[model samples]
Target chain A: MQVFELIIGKLLPYATLVILIVGLLYRLNRWQRAAVGNIALYPSAATRWRLFGKVLSEVTLFSSFRQENQALWKRTWPFHVSLFLILLGHTRLITDWPLRVGLGLSEGTVNAISAWGGGICGVVALMTCLLLLARRFGIQRVREISTGEDYGVLILLLFILLTGNAMRFFTHYDIAEIQQYFRTLFSTAPTQVPHDPLVLLHFLMVQLLLIYFPFGKFLHVPGVFYSKTLLAKDY
Target chain B: MEGHVQVNETELQTVIDQVKAIKNGPRVLQLYMDICAHCGVCAEQCHVARTMPESRTNPAARSDHIRQLYKRYGSTWGQVLKAIGAARDITEDEVAVWQRDFYECSGCRRCAKFCPFGIDNSILTRKGRAVVHALGKSPFMMSETQRISDETGNDEGQTYAAFVEACRFLCEEVKDDWDIDVEIPIDRKGADILFIPASADLVSFPETHMGVAVFFKALEIHDGTTWTMASTAFDGANFGLFTGDDPHMARKNQAAYDACIDLGVKKLVIGECGHAYRIAKRMGPTASHFGNPFETTNIFLLADEYLQKGVLKFDKRKVDEIITYHDPCNFARSTNVFEEPRRLLSAMTDNFVEMTPNRTENWCCGGGGGLAVMDGAEKVEMIDGTFLDYRMKVGKMKVDQIMATGANYCAAPCANCKRQLMQLMEHYETGVKIGGVFDILGNAIVLEETKVKAGAKVAS
Candidate 1:
């Protein structure tokens, strides 16, 4: 309990910090939506379905990766795959109720999967970040077009993953304490939160990422799905 | 030696110098120079580029050849250094290849329509041809056609006797077929419309010419006249539009306009050549020699207006055969004459199946731009390479749609489209016949109130 209280001392401020950052992201999305309303020329149900299918194929399945320049595709596919897997691994942090209800697994089993997924994601993320950064600076056309924002996104993502995996794999943190902190925030209960420094660092980095995502082409993660799929030539 | 004129070097050089002086005369050239992005999207969209072997898929390869001249003359030192670094140079052999390539294109705006930036590649091709023309390097066929246009007022060099004889023959044929004494008036003053078609229609595409004559006869309207101009401008087929010489372009248009004005016709109805119509309707007004406020309504627009007002009627029972319409790239994309043709087709036929990429998105028949008239074996490489491939791919898709419907006829208004579609049909052996929109209309024209002449039969 004392250890939990100490962890909460460091992490509570970041909860407020995450709230503020998420608020900014919401505002940015709202602003963009207002700015570019109804820009699609041919909006229809069939078009929507086509666009949805295309986005799923492109972003999740990396359908376009197959047709893209081969060397670039190889580096990009692994990075994207790792990032998605890492995101899925983090679902346990948000809601343990799903694991409790669906799997009926003990906390130990859930923790093992999370840790394994997190570690694999971290290794792939670091390697991808390194290779992509090298290629962006090395390739003539890519180098010419890449901005400071591009490098910043790559570096920040690397930091988040590195810190996340280090805390999960290297340090022994109480999963119940982390889950209880999340449950308190969700339920509006003023419970004491985790105070682990590595957890606090991870939360801070994630909040910063949320604040940054809307402002940069990182928004293109969603934007490309809409543009490429929705606007693709029908015939 | 028979119909060809000998090229005088000194005179040709003088003409070239004169053209070079006026090359930068128009704001159009400035607009062209500033607007193009060189994204090669035009080349990518171009059927010629797609169908051409990897060795020659770049349509802009010729334009790039001419771009060297622009870089040499128009660019700053930094630009020159960049061009030099890129190994760009204008040489005689390069010039010769450009001449062949420039002529090989049908000047269809299929590429222009698909370009994200709207870079008017056909216009640039024309401009390049103009530069080549200035250098006395015009292709022999085009130059000969231009010469015939200059001397005989038409490309075919048809005399007034032949012109009248053809008209009379058509009138007699109409009288024999339709049982009507429809007079095709010549040299009548204050006619509502002065109908000027390419001489090709009178001789080669008789069915289309007869369609026009039938259209006029069925309306029982006599306010139109056809004339063979006293000078070389009788044919509206502007070879200069293809070759890119503005003065020669101006000369051809000026002659046509002068004849129209001389006849005191209120409106000039140009026949179904896409570039010819574009030149007459758009470029003619801009050429300084035409003296601005140049007035002409495309014949297609006239047809549309008439059809809308119930001035024209057709018996759809006559056209029971399944048909599809190919929008000539010029009329479809360039001039926005898409809906009217379809409207006409719908009225004329019961089974009008639209090709997949119909209207603005329709593919070129691989023979527009100026490739239709260009005489060279290398043209096969351009057509079979780019135009044919584009048409075939798009055409195969269209052909499949067409085959699914089991349509026997494909109706295209533009002569170039008809010509190209004919070749495609032959190449693919698609077992489909191609003709003009009015050919269908003429076949379907039912004389209800108007009495047919006792002995008249439809002219073939």
Candidate 2:
């Protein structure tokens, strides 16, 4: 188990990073290389600046999603927003220079802020994820369209959130030690991983997610930009 | 599944090969096939899904026919992804479903507006239709129109002599009905504008054709710029778009482009047919990047320019009925021509009311994607229930929208839209008069100079 933890902590991260980067680059290259037809939906932005603004609003605010399905948007918008915050909050596990020290906050304040703010975002993301999963199961139309991967993605996020929240609320770890572990891991050296099972589980799940990211619907992050530009650009 | 076409093993192999080709085809399509989250937001937005209430009618559900094939043949790793419920092999039954369901979508693209990913299922629908068309499994009406368009350069099968006779007849009709002496010029060399409307407008909605003739006459009188209809390529409606036949679409587009160069027209002004305008402006060889000799403009943009310039005189008092515009899918969504028609309608009628969701968000008129031209079981070879029945059923949303507006007339400018809405109104007994925007324009256009022109023609 210690060896397993060591590999998860020290070795697999490099593989995960390499695979994630190369896989994403390969995916982007494929999309870029494919022939594009003139199929843009009209009444789109006429100028590049407006087109950028339109695509930006769509990505940042889910503007088009809000226009029609406000109910789904209510849950999906918060779920995405909270997920983004949680991802940003994960800098705590790495170096806190940007999220904490950049803000000139003390370690005590950062920890307290992390416990409250991160706790809130984690809870929001968890609740929205549950609601979205329920929607998949409950709504017949949604169920009809959904595949196993759809269910698997939501459930994967559920496990990730549950493990993450368990660590945030149930246990306390030394920030310096976790950051040092990431530092040593990044430097190609062996280091002590956090002994918490939830930490290990969360780390393993996140790595698995990153490995799978470029291969699946998680590419929606990059894809939304390409599709919005493709579909909505007028001139 | 009843009465569906069956493919032999060789044909099935051919289909699989084609699906593999599509799986490798366009970036937009490849990304769309890969990244759809199956969120079902598109189902709610689809008029066919709402009215039909079937899983197959759902946008994503219909698109899944292609996605399943794409997964199996798209990549080497696709097999591994199948374990996660992402990939599947193409099957005969799925191909049969493709024939029925892909045609059912009007390709209105309303679903794209609500899709969080902006995934246009219409593109997928076209791909599916292309596969079916390759197998020669397109519905009887779709394939017939394509053949007719290919043979006669127009879907209506109107011969060139018949086209010339129709133009002469329309000139007399304009004189008798509106008391205006307007010349419907044919193949006039060095004309500034070349007008190509749906050929159906010549037979089915001649008033729209008449309205354009008058509008052109007014343009000539206003700026000495003239327009002519080519005897060789007067029809703008191309079923190639409907059947996803790229070669046929390009061939039909070449006919129109050749006419422009032959007549030496500076601009090609497409009449009120929606898909035709979209093709001429964007999809065809006339697309801007091709750098064709002539510019393309629509009737609404031209007429709206005149209205904005205060050059054309419209007697709003002539149009007494309450009128609302039905935004044709290709016009409103595909080509962004919603506002120009509405602006003209507002000037032409005092009682112009709007349907609840007008413009780009408007409901499809149930007859888009060449469904307007297709009547189910019209020919012996047609399988499944009649498309006429299907159109009426899916058009319920549009009928409801028109009824809610309480308008006496619904001015839908596209030839396909006019035919569909007229049939739909008749089917639903909605008591709504359906016609083109130019039909209303023809009704209200006051020809102050036309009376003198009529006298001069009489004197001559």
Candidate 3:
């Protein structure tokens, strides 16, 4: 158990951070190298600001999908939004007290957010992620494109979410111990880790996921920014 | 499959190399390959996808056929990963399917309209066609047209004497039919505008040539403009766009450039061939050998400008029928000449109506991407069925659009659109009279009061 904690809770986090950065750089470099000239699409100069507004709105609103298919945007929009909420909830780990003071919220308000709001966010993410995974199996047209790699990537994400929710709802974690442990892992100095089985398992899943990020469908996250129309100047 | 393409291993390597070395397309090519969510939004926009069940005209499927190749061979990691089912390999029999699918696309770019990312699969399809062409495996008709253009400098292989004879014959027809003595000046130096239209216009659709002559006559009196057609480089349609052969496109464009230099014209005007207009105005300047030093304008845009400035007068009653315009894919989407044609249409008729989705969002006539000249009306490639049937199937959506408009006349400006559209009207018995936009211009142009004095001034 200690050895598993040492590997997942202590060493793998930093190793995966290096892997994540290097993997991202390698994939980004491949894209840069493969990109032809300015094969982008945009409206005329009169509405050039629309392009920026469009990319921003698409990430936030899924307006493009709405225009094409109403039902699709319904599922896809919430899936992405829930993922975002879960990410925001995780900011609680890095520095909650400082952010709480900055926002002028009381400790009781912070505790309610940490316990209730974060729980709701995780559950929503869990539901949306499961539905999104099930979607590939539900539709035949989508199934044609869904590879083992695509499913494998999603399965990994689902595991990360499952372990995260386990820690969030069932397993009790020491907040100060966990915060100090992350600070150690991120900083030059190394220290002992919070050894909750669910927390360690969640951390290990995320570490493996980070290492495998660029080799699979996860590239689509960064890829949306480089989508053809987003970079285009004319139709 | 016949004369040129038996693609050996070395030839395969060269063709694949050309695809991997895409310098002209954007960096979004990678994004295009990766970003498709397979939402299939573009399927409805594609006329083929709507009409043909056998072809699987789904834009994503069409894109994937090429993207599969890019994924399989585009990179080393892709090649290695493909073995373990990360991506799949494109097999030999699939090459035939790839060629057919690429050719079947019509390269309309309508799919890009619905694509959330603006991933124009036509761009990728053209690249696919380019690689196929590099392997000498483009559709036989496309390669034949390019060869004719290469050897004889025009689509028909119309010799210098034959071209002169045709021009003189058309001039006689104009004088007899319209009672207007119009001479198609050939190789006239220092003309203000050089007109280069598709060569097939002279013989197949003489009315279009007659229309241009009348429009030019009005322009002569009103705008004081002088124009001439070069005998050697008269055809404007570059088969390079269809076959996806860039060198051929550049070389053919150079022929027109040489003609412009030979005439020393102030501007170059592309006649009503949509793809040709796109090539000359958009790609020709840079793809051209001698740089474009003067202005390049679509004839419709120029005519609209003349009409707006009161330089040309049209007797609207002469074109009295209810008119609806078929926006050529190249003109409407790629080149931005849609408004000018509509503006000119309004000038010539009171009954001009817009089809449900007009302009950039318009449906293609299925004759685009060099398909019209394939003339499925006569021949189908390797398929067992008739090519005319193939054309009709793809053209079914366009036929529906025009039929819904209930317009008696469709002014299809591009010759390619006109040919395929004429077939649609005939097969469907839609009773829609299809002609060039200039055909309407010729019918309604008031030339009795017009004189050639503008030409005399420009000549001086």
Q: In lDDT terms, which candidate is top?
A: 2
What DockQ was computed for model 3?
Answer: 0.40
Model 1 chain B: ten consecutive residues of lowest lDDT: B222-231
For each of the candidates, give the backbone clash count: 31, 2, 7
Residue B58 alpha-carbon offset, candidate 1, angstroms: 1.9
Worst 10 residues of 1 chain A by lDDT: A35-44
Q: What C-alpha lDDT, on a 0 to 100 scale, does residue A173 get in candidate 1?
A: 88
Give the native contact fraction of candidate 3.
0.35
Q: Residue-wise lDDT of candidate 3 within B230-340, one digit each (tens)?
A: 987889888998887988998998888888877888788888888887788667652322356767777988888887887766788787788999888888777777678
In terms of lDDT, which candidate is stronger, 1 or 3? 3
Q: Considering only chain B, report the TM-score of each candidate against the true chain B.
A: 0.81, 0.95, 0.91
Candidate 3 residue runs with Cα over 4 Å from true position: A30-50, A95-135, A166-175, A229-231, B1-26, B54-56, B286-291, B375-386, B447-460
TM-score of each: 0.59, 0.96, 0.89
Per-residue CA lDDT of candidate 2, range B1-460, in tens? 9647564677677667877786568898878877888889999998899998878888998888777777777677878778888877766565566778888898999999878998999888888889888988888889999998899999999998899999999989988988777788888999999999999999999999998988887777777778899999999999999999999999998899999999999999899888999999998887767888889888888889988999878898899999988889898899888788888888888899999898888989888888888886644232367988888888998999999998999999888899999998899898999888887787798765655575446425
- Tell me the deviation in Å of residue B443 in model 2: 2.1
At residue B309, what lDDT does model 1 achieve?
78
Most TM-score-accurate candidate: 2
DockQ ranking from best candidate downward:
2, 3, 1
Among residues 3 or more apart in sequence or in different chains, the pairs in candidate 3 whose N, CA or C atoms overlap within 3 Å are A35-B27, A36-B26, A36-B27, A39-B26, A40-A232, A41-A232, B376-B388
- Candidate 3, overall lDDT? 0.75
Model 2, runs deviating above 4 Å:
B1-7, B378-384, B458-460
